[model samples]
Target: MPTTAVDPYLDGNFAPVRKEITTDNLQVVGQLPPDLAGMFVRNGPNPQWPPIGKYHWFDGDGMLHGVQISDGKASYRNRYVQTRGWKIEHEAGKAIWSGFLEAPQMDNPHGAYKNTGNTALIWHAGQILALNEGGVPHAIKLPELGTIGEYTYNGKLVSAFTAHPKVDPVTGEMMFFGYSFMPPYLQYSIVSAAGELLQTVPIDIPQPVMMHDFAITENYTIFMDLPLTLSAERAHRGEPLLMFESDRPSRFGIVPRLGNNNNIRWFESSPCYVFHTLNAYEAGDEVVLIASRMSSTSVLVSEDNQLDPDANIPRLHQWRFNLKTGTVREQQLDDVAAEFPRVNENFLGQKTRYGYVGKLANNPLPLFDGVIKYDLSSGTSQTHQFGEGRYGGEAVFAPRPGATNEDDGWLITFVYDEGSGTSELVVVNAQDITSEPVARVIIPQRVPYGFHGTWVSEEQLTINY
Candidate 1:
């Protein structure tokens, strides 16, 4: 890592790497699974130049890192998302827009502000979108991973797109909603499996909240209207414009699959914040929502906010909303702190027993030292630690081509070995996570730590444009 001034996110494994390379026939350890064929792409913050002011991990430029596997051979490549903001900065040869922690400048020929597109990357409508909740998505060309330009659902996307969108495995319909800092605070949209924007509806909300992610079931789409919010008046007072409010109550708005905004039923719960959900499903007349919840989001007050560094952090929390009696039940599922929850796509929006999440370290920084596999049936879990001085990104499960069992797959992730200052693509057997990895494809450079990712199967690759 390069020596620099104090920057929380720019140091350690979170440091930025400025090079992009492509190489085939990567070196591998152990035997690679023959059934695992496709690409695993992850997005993270990688700034081209030093930030002008305070930097938030989410404000850095977007970069896509991928490893392709065919038969037993693996290949690797990475590139910037080529967003409008990044291109402008690249041309100027220096930093322009201020980071998430501050306001942006008024002089910009590029229409959009810093849509760095640095967040979750997912496959939808036969296209891959590099996303950031602050703005719309940038579509990246498939296979080669080149930026094609901004995707607007064919100009139907009137507002920003969410970094997290739920794709139904049954209908092949992708359900997404976007929240903004201004009027029409929230809106929901649906995209067809064939890459067409079918419908969009304006949603009514009392105020703008940080809706990072949401959940979907067989019939309902759940949206979180938590307390943390952004305000222009508060910014002038020197307080963080976007912050968590202690007096506000958390609300969950449950709406029908194809219903309009007026049909929403808002259910209140204890004030909390959720960055990601494990999964959601339907059981009788109740909707089950499982996510990683934080009791108070005060830690987001500032980039250096560590209100309770020694205290227990966010954990697996469960909530059951009944459609019959208008009542809500909530409880803690586990004591272990975890985030970036993922479930097998084979069982998305349906009842299943397993879930995968990254286990947080003891340090004040948000780093995952291990991955935990949760068995919802027995209330038990198995963890795979990357040993000391090693950290990993989210664990995404890749299903076997024609497997019957839900857990019959492999858990894929990028592990950064801080000691060696290098990274590797590790594949762990989903059925037995505690055992050694099935294979480890060595990546020549370090993969900076970031947020959520997805697994794109080879069959999906053939259908994309």
Candidate 2:
């Protein structure tokens, strides 16, 4: 008899928690900030049943873990996004669909693939949306964290939505784009401050690629056309459906706000991959983009379908696309490997001095041992270590009410202590990242390591639904 191999992603903190419980007055290790009020919610994969095939980290049902704080008291709750697929699987009592790593199951009763809304979360248009790039967004109610239903902007959103949408702080408009495996490979859309879907424009691309995230500036939106491309023909030829051609050049498409494909300008760079961007801004004659860059990645599938034994690590990098000269200048900003970069939302489309990112560990699986705060203007950074045997996910910035300075806020994230087998929400002062946490709200249950999160202030929740 042969032993089954253990999937690293399905073990340890990456594993899912089954119980859905709500507890108030969570014990605190330190004093909570008086002004810090609202909820910190993060979305990630949590499979409801045993997977039908080989399981990947990205293949799981969407579950949200939220910690709400108000008046120096905190509460914790978690719930599944309850997408159509989740409901169907619940009725079936088993896994009906496979994951992205496997070929599409054309004859599945429910559908070819499941739209597991297990990637990221966004709060816009007076509702919280749990987003999976391959499907439409699902609205989730706050305080209770219950799924309302699929949100289509009154049937205005007819295409898949990006997990990452840029909400312009000054203009109060949300800018996002969607990519597809078919013709009209990409589409860009915008929503007014009041939550109405304004317009959707088709952008031309050579092939269908897995574009996980993009960047936005004050005057323009930048889309990455990397070489990680998808091809049905390749699948028919018994090769990987997605392949990274290192010989090809990575292209950046810069388009003016509400501009069409005709007005888009393409800038080329060496072959690379960027999963997340810190920020982008317009400076003089150039559009500046700051993100974590890698020479190549085995995120989806490698060039030949087999996983690359030596995966590339991403590092802090910068790219300046010169609009006037039609040229690009790129450089590595730091030597340390990091990802899940974030900045103050208020300064998202403007020049920012400080940014936060998770420091990657050398383990074979994905893990963040600490958070690094970078001062871009001074070319310096500070790290907030999670201590020995402690790991954390992406740290989100919680801006103080009426904060005048960019870094005048707190960085909040769920930190899991491996030694104790417990989890706590650690709040560090954004202005002083090297200092100890201002507060630590101990969670009643274990929080598995997950993807992106956001900080919704108490004022934002006051709006009537």
Candidate 3:
């Protein structure tokens, strides 16, 4: 590995490489958890209560579900599970109340566009709302222009407002990084959880760019920079922003969370083909930014205006950066094309950091995937294979509070089986990554691909809100 002021890029393979993993070999330990194990799939009665507390996925079919896992299986429910309609004001000094209307059913609506990928639904003020693609309201409410109302129940008029907000879990504040289709620029704003504007920080970074994802800590907002060409080409043909790469130096920048919009620190490097995931977790006194970077062929542009991308996409880089120390390290993994990195910790016996990396296969479909355990101190990793042509998403590790570290906790993954042409939401024992998945629940329908998700704690489950 080459070492430099920044981290060195190296050549040798850092870990073992394999071609495929088999799911049949994986052992199924126990029955799925009670909430998920049941045969009866239920939805609504109470319109006031929020849907299932766990992570809910929008399949773009007007079909949304809150997924829960226990004993190795997952169960899902619709967004209308607990929806009550809104009240509309009328002329005769009266109001008209409507009932909960069933959410629209579509055929994989979101997959046509990547906007509804991981981290799509946000839990705010006791309600989990799915933001519509762009500012068009989907599962949530939309207010009319100039009028401010306390609630947005029906499609009727309410307070005019901006939509699809990302709220801070710790502070309970709604936020957004503004996106536009015309000029293709990125903007930022902060709002109240109720969709009221508190601040709009217009930090005009550059043009013709789109924000695939953004990360926020208590102190700052981090945005990954990418080329506008990907979206531009598709726009001409009336399509969603698709794949296009640029040779320009890729950059990552940060600014104070509530400070002036102009305050930003920019750092450039080889283009990150994809910022697969961005997470901020508190490590002692510092907030660390861990990003998984994939190489892009867009970095070989000439001053003479060449159109073709460079020969090959470079190796993947896992980066760690400190906002306070201004330090960044890029670690290169040998043979392993790391993607879908999920961070979690086991606090029972020893407080240790753990991450699961989805390793890609060499096959044409690239369906072969493996799970890796990343040790923070040693900076080394290990892998557990599930099988050939089987792709896994961010693994969710659920441990009972105070359970000993030696006792492997429950690990959940959304596995895609190519042969079945469907996906299974499975759970396993975290301690034994190679062990057979304990509970495997075959989803009734095929789910489209998506991004980040979180497990809602049991204490938060209820429909009263």
Of the candidates shown, which would achieve the greatest lDDT relative to the real structure? 2
Question: TM-score for each prediction?
Answer: 0.96, 0.98, 0.61
Model 2, 1-465: lDDT tens digits are 999887777888888899999999999998999999999999999999988877888999999999999999999999998999999999999988988778889898888978888889888867888899998999888878899999899999967899999999999899988999898999999999999999999999999988989998999999999988989999999888877778889999999988989999999999888899999999999999999998887777623343443346889999999999999999999989899999999999899999999999877677999999999999999999999999999999999999999999999999999999999999999988998899999999999999989888897777615
Which residue pairs show backbone clashes in model 1? none
lDDT of 3 by residue, 287-324 (tens): 45554555543222211233444222223344555656
TM-score of the candidate numbered 2? Answer: 0.98
Flag regions of model 1 displaced more than 4 Å.
1-4, 106-112, 303-312
Q: CA lDDT, every prediction? A: 0.87, 0.91, 0.45
Candidate 1 local lDDT, 1-465, one digit each (tens)? 998677879888888998899999999999889889999999999999989878888878999999999989999999999988899899999988877665655565654268888898879877889999878899887678899999887688887888998899888889888898788899888888777888889888888888889988888899999888878678778778788775788999889989778899989998788888889998898899999998876554555363644223789999999989889999999999898899998788898899999999987788888899999999999999887998898999999888999999999999988899889999999999999899999998888997777888998888666
* Model 2 ranges with Cα > 4 A deviation: 302-310
Query: What's the CA error at residue 220 for candidate 1, in Å?
Result: 0.6
